[model samples]
Target: MMPSIKFLRIIVVLSASLLFGCSDKSVDQAEFPPDKTAAVEVNGSDYSIEKGGYRWVRKKGLETETVTTDHASPNQMAEHLQPISVKSGQKVKVKIEDNPILNVFLWNQSGKEKEIKLEDDQITVPADKGTYIYEVLAEWKNGEISYTFVAEVQ
Candidate 1:
């Protein structure tokens, strides 16, 4: 068997080499893009923060539980709703029966989803030329209802 001092020295040298050798591989920050990045946009005197890649701007005072509604169900709420067609850069109005409190989310053809805030029962259509599908969720004391509609932009 080796002497105690020699054994200690061998252990120290091996530990030092392993620790120092592993740290030499430092990652380059430039090679990896940030998972979230913010862009500042200035229009006139107002500035807005635009986020890239799955980040969305939050709209206050609108929240609802998302529940899937079957289109075949006799209680289908969408059957009572109407589809909308709009020109590019035009705004579309969406009115719900009884105007129940609900949350509206729009999923674009590009697969990007956004929650829209209704002002006077209207939502502005996307400026990009594409058809967008919208989902509206409403919950009441008794039960819940989900309505869907399509907005076409030519």
Candidate 2:
């Protein structure tokens, strides 16, 4: 009877430890593809940005897998989205859920692309009045994602 009771106690302890350990591991290894949220702020309004191409590395235990996807260009992705209105030369804020390195660019209708310098997570809208498409490339330690949004400067 004494031996049986000891054995039962050991089993219970091991079971609890295993369950807690597994849960910790799952939390450490984030979801296969992280859920990333991105947006643009214009005139105190937040506009969700469309996600574009991406190359990400997913890790599980000691193994890692690279996932790559190619999507339409920034202009193409913006075509379907209603342009967010902004004042010419106004500052537009880029809001992403995580702190990833960001590279921003603006595209004109004629297919010209120009990199925009970001200051305090904000970019100045094009001075000229017209519609413009923006591409934001965000890179984390484990992955990279491209986002797009269209803005019409009045």
Candidate 3:
């Protein structure tokens, strides 16, 4: 048994060594205490921080939920495209926002998935325009994400 002061000194030395880099002949595990790392959960993820317009994690096993920035805040985002409703054969110039990671899929009551091509962040929908219900899902780089935006096109 060693004095508490002496034990503390050994701990400090071991911590400094680990910070620089560990060696094959490692010190006693008791000397170096384990870090108290706690995961922050938010949006259904152990991570709760945003960086580079994306969510990140210090370790892997932790699953994270992600949503495209545009879809994440359609109401607050000015560039987000609002669902369009036009008369039959109206030929509206769909104004889509340009988002490289935004996966926009137009689904109608017909239960069909139509991937709309993005040009200038918008696409013209050639719907017959008869009170059609459509759902737009905007996906981000993270699969644990989805933005369900619905609109009625008449």
Candidate 4:
């Protein structure tokens, strides 16, 4: 009877360890959504960015999930936020955490979008003086996020 009791104890310990080990590994592999701030720099000054719509893939334990959220367009998103004043044709630096792949666009008031070329993590603002909405689409291996900012060219 004593030998049987000892065997049962060992089995329970081994089972518990295996369960915890698998859980820990899953937690390590799980990728959480982005919680960091994205910003833009203009002439050595940094401005905060407003987060926009996103489609992300999240993993937890043994389950995988695709999470997507829709928000207003870049031009509409800019309406609620204050615009950052910048000189016309100034070089604005894109600052996103984790250095994700970035695709930038310029949005006119008419709801049209034009892709802006990003050179060395920086984009040149429009040459004309007006208010423009900018969208920064950032992507990682697991997810993608859209960030918006309004820029007023002086």
Candidate 5:
């Protein structure tokens, strides 16, 4: 397929920025090859490295699918807690509400649990093919409330 004109414009802009030193910030020359690729920092808790014109390490916990929800209390927002059916290499995003102090966890079938740090009030689904238990904890001034959302991947 032919490269889009917009993509070509981006390449030109990035190339010019690199050659002209448009910004005061200095990037490691050895790491970022000026010929075809460049290293850029993405602002977030997600850890990543840009190389070969692609990100080597993805920020998701699993290598495949990712899941996120908009509801801080999935139970209260029962509509958002519905089971999602996603194919391989797809992302599941649910729209709901949000909370200031919220803690989320994902429990896999293997009995291993992972703490999910919400980005834009969402979390990524695991790469496994089974039932996943999503636990959401919200803290208020008086006490804390918990919610759960389940997702099944095929």
Candidate 6:
């Protein structure tokens, strides 16, 4: 029996479609090469680090899915702050490991918790041009991530 013209076209189209069927992979799905970074002194002698150096260091893994509901965290991403020192009233940059830039916050240390925005990675807080311990609440997927670091108000 002879197939109709439409049926023949359909079969041809299907055959071509199969030829173009996706491979078992995609560019994005392909395993990315491991990342590496250079070590450098940050904020002078106060601290030193390598970009994206410390992360995913656990025998187990985390399963938190619902992302960044607030700006807090359970632990420190690093033992030292990115820029441990900064001048008070002067703009300083900072970033919490595995967190967003906007997630970083500044508290006045005045009993009342005031959240201030950051520039680049640091926030400017007006101090008496001396030394101070600023409680910075960095943003995390779970809540307000806090870090106690010293900044000199110069």
Top TM-score hit: 2
Q: Compose the digit string of candidate 6's lDDT tens values, residues 38-93.
A: 12223443332223211222111232322222322212332344434455556655
Task: Return the candidate ranking by lDDT, descending.
Answer: 2, 4, 1, 5, 6, 3
- Please state the error at residue 148 of candidate 4 in Å: 0.8
TM-score (C-alpha) between model 4 and the true structure: 0.81
lDDT (0 to 1) per candidate: 0.48, 0.88, 0.37, 0.87, 0.46, 0.43
Model 4 scores a C-alpha lDDT of 0.87
Give the poorly placed runs of model 6, Cα more than 4 Å off.
1-85, 101-110, 142-144
Which residue pairs show collisions in model 5?
66-125, 67-123, 67-124, 67-125, 70-97, 71-97
What ranges in model 3 sit over 4 Å off? 1-100
- Encode model 4's per-residue lDDT on 1-154: one tens digit a residue: 2679889999999999998876644455444565757999998989999999988886665789788999998888988989999998999999988889999988877775789999999999888999889999999888888999988899
Tens digits of per-residue lDDT, candidate 2, 42-127, equal 88889999999998897667888999998988887877988899998999999997889999988766663889999999999878
TM-score (C-alpha) between model 5 and the true structure: 0.38
**Tens-place lDDT digits, model 5, residues 53-93:** 11112122333322232423332333344554544434433
Clashes of 3: 3
Question: Considering summed lDDT, which 10 consecutive residues are worst modelled in model 1?
Answer: 46-55
TM-score-wise, the better of 4 and 5 is 4
Off by more than 4 A, model 4: 1-16, 22-31, 60-62
Better of 2 and 6 by lDDT: 2
User: Model 2, stretches more than 4 Å misplaced?
Assistant: 1-8, 15-29, 110-112
lDDT of 1 by residue, 13-127 (tens): 9999999877845433332222222111112221212111121122223533332323432123323434455667665554444445666677544442778886665567778
What is the Cα root-mean-square deviation between model 3 and the actual structure? Answer: 14.2
Model 1 misplaced regions, further than 4 Å: 1-83, 108-112
Q: Flag clash pairs in model 3.
A: 96-121, 96-122, 97-121
Candidate 2 lDDT score at position 20 = 91
